[model samples]
Target: MKKLACTLIFILLSCHLFAQDETHPFTIRGLIYDEKTNERLEGAVVSSGDNASAMSDKTGFFQLRLDRKAEKLKVKLVGYEEKNLVIDFDDESEVKLIIRLTPEPILLQGVTVTGEHFTEEPVVNSYSIHPGDLSKVPQFIEADAFRAFQALPGVTTAADMSSQISVRGGNYDETLVFLDGIPVYNPYHLVGVFSMFNSDILQNERLYMSNYPVSYGGALSSVLELNSKQGNNERIKGSAALGLASAKIALDGPLWGGNFLISGRRTYFDFLTRMIMGIRFPYYFYDLYSKYVYPLSKNNLLTVSAFYSRDALGLDDDKVFVAQKEIPNWGNLFLNFSDEYFLKEKSSVELKAFMSRASLGVNTQVFFTDYYHQMGTTDTTTVNNYIEDFTARLTFNSHPDGQALAVGLEAKREAIHYDWNIDETDLNGMYIHPLESLFFDFAPSQYSYSGDEFYLNAFVTDKVTISPVSELTAGLRGSYIKNLKTFLLLPSFSFSYNFLPNLQVHLSYGRYFQNTYSLKERKTEAVFTPFMATFFPEDKENIPYSDHYASGLVLSDIFSEKTSLEVEGYFKDRNNLA
Candidate 1:
């Protein structure tokens, strides 16, 4: 009888302990997703109040075991808002959760738009400035992007009449400009007095004065990166402005479950003069820009961008003094298509295809009399310049182990055509150069060239935080130009250290290469007519390149809020100038 009672008591005690264990599992399971796209998000970390944490797998699934006293859980991921939840321990059951996080980009330096206006934010880089603040500065005819650049350090304008900028004592052609992720061979309008970009459409602009990243090549001096705003996904908005020289309008709205934006600008001096005064002003320019964004799926997004600009000048043959008719026209056109895909493993991939073309044409007709007023002659000249490029690029970006890694490949096919012909009589020369060459007459001049070349470029960059007070960025770029059959390896490095809470130091070094060079032509009356020239190997050894070294010191909050003082110096070594 005693043995039976003992066995029963032991079994009852064991059952009670097992029941208590089953009641409090202390385990939580979850699946994370993107709030906007409804796509699974991997690499997210889920942590409890007890400091127990687990990372989501490729399937966005995670399981965590928490302390019995833990009542709160949190989830965190880069480029996403943090999510928190409260646990119900009273339920006494395993907790399963489906958490969604909103996407948020981490910007090192940029502006924040509140309502319809943007607020200027202090940037760590002294060269970085908010594009919206450009309007507050004084304007020459209109708010010009290049003019704003001139206000920055190490940048200078060629003249009051020109908007082109020279950086670090480098020529304008050495600087590169990028709009919406594509290179713009020429980004000027209205005789180089205005930038082609419309300020209303610009979201941000960043200038790298020296030792820029290696992801960009084909420039020896500096880089200007401009990004246009995406359309309003929730509502329709429009803005219009009329200045003394030009009129611009922008419209953005939702379309077909996507978003679209279109902006345009045109100089109206010629139009107004023709309409009000009934006179031929003979000069005008117009520019158009458009972009479209669509989410093809939860993990894929598509975007399209297009730009066109033209400047035209015309003169009649019945002019009073010169009796010469001259027609000059130049324009740029580009189209870009891009796709971004979100992948597992805390990474994303972007693919882009772009087509660009620039065209220049000038035709002249002159009817003149000799200096002695005895002979009459007519001379005609025609010139054409064209550059066309097709480019394909693939880029992969990832955040792994607290470091940012970027790798990309680009292939471009460039074609160029240049031709000129002059038809003139012997008297044409005597009429113009009577004192110097009255007895000698000039012969007809003609030249033509048409060629195409392929280029391949690849780059990789890694940004790492060395310590709490220091960071490092290093990259390398390799480029191969088919015509020259030469390869170039460019490397760049940047390091930043915080000497104090309010003081910092920066050091950078970079090597850059350029395959295209700009040639400013003086054949026309226009002040500036720049044409692009590509490499044609004679000896296959003359490739232009430059090395840049720079250092800067910044002191923040010296006097007031959002105020800082910075001093920087740079040196550039250019080689093989053509």
Candidate 2:
């Protein structure tokens, strides 16, 4: 019996040894993706030690046979990420894995808004500014987007020399300005000294000094795009401050447990100005902005934006002789609304609508004056003008890699009907739209005129990798421009060369055109001065402009581009409506 027990134990040990030798040939496989985006990686390699290795596919997938003796695996990828996997291949069973890569943290130092939209992809002729760096620049005050702009190369000294702000030799008229998708004809509120935007609430200010993509056209010289804060989805926050011309307060936070972003900003400078200036009456200026964003579902966002501004330069009440009676009644109004909608990510499409009005009227207190001007003969000039624009547009946004892109499209229409009626004419008083004078001789005492314009434009840009040292971007744009009644095309191209890891070289070329022109050409320095609206006998005389722009930016991570001492130059030529 004892002998039988010993033999049975020996048999059991033999069986165990044989089982160990038959170790199951297990295989482990996984796909790699960006942590935040869940985007798959391409061309990644997973090697155990050169001999024991496997390469990952474009989808970041790799399969390696497990050896009972092998223990660890090493992974590497160019320009992206590298990592090591700890595994014990001693088991005979199959192992599945989802490998993760750690992204390299990079400190940015360049133009403020230019680089924020697409960091992964190579953008042509764009400056990327980080708020962290902007906060440290000494020459510019905080929140002064334009001030930061003045520090870049390619910026002309003309405006600075003339004590003005002109970017890339572009006249103030030639620059296109926008804030939170709202077209801002005038970016300044306090005589060019202060921008209308609140820096504290400002998220980014992108400047296309030249060679902007097909997605952005219509402006001749430059494009200054201001992005307001989208509000924190994770927290509620607000700020209030008093400046020289105004005092403002802003509030933003999450709604419904952090699914929605709501924010609002308002300024009561006139009230503060009146208090500080020791004025008997209120001589003030004020502006307000509000925005709400909600994610209806994954990959979809809905946003509502609003703005309001009023400038009361000064007010006066007077009595004038009208034939046989003394009449007294006077007030002026400056009001505006800017709103937009953004849908889709990177392929973002927007519907934009806005209205602006500046009115001055005088007449008897009891008359047909419900937002209407008075017509009389007592040295009184009534100027009333209304402008409305609606645009649906698409924007082309790309990341450092072509794998992600942001594109948008839009349609736009605008109407202008402004009038100038003269009562106490200087007999020879002359008032004309700056452009009208260039085309026709006119007087400030003219009647009202009207104009209607429409535009439709679409743009798409993609980020593509050329090689380890270079990135390429290709973009296309199509447009339906009215008033001239035609379709136009704007194409743009740009590339960046990381000549050295620390130094980046950029080049961009683009075609840009303008379908509309501003009536207020750049002459009025004072607010109370008379405003002259130019008239056109026919809209056909107003010719559309065609322009071409090229630019380059040299960026560095070791130094801030603004203060890094860059040297840039550009050349532009165009024909004015002569």
Candidate with best TM-score: 1
Please, what is the whole-model Cα lDDT of each candidate in the order they appear? 0.70, 0.50
Decoy 1 TM-score against native:
0.75
**Candidate 2 lDDT:** 0.50
Residue 190 error for model 1, in Å? Answer: 1.4
Quote the positional error of residue 308 for candidate 1 in Å. Answer: 0.7
Off by over 4 Å in 1: 1-126, 317-327, 363-376, 422-445, 519-527, 530-538
User: What's the distance in Å from true for residue 30, model 1?
Assistant: 17
Q: How far is candidate 1 from the true structure (C-alpha RMSD, Å)?
A: 14.1
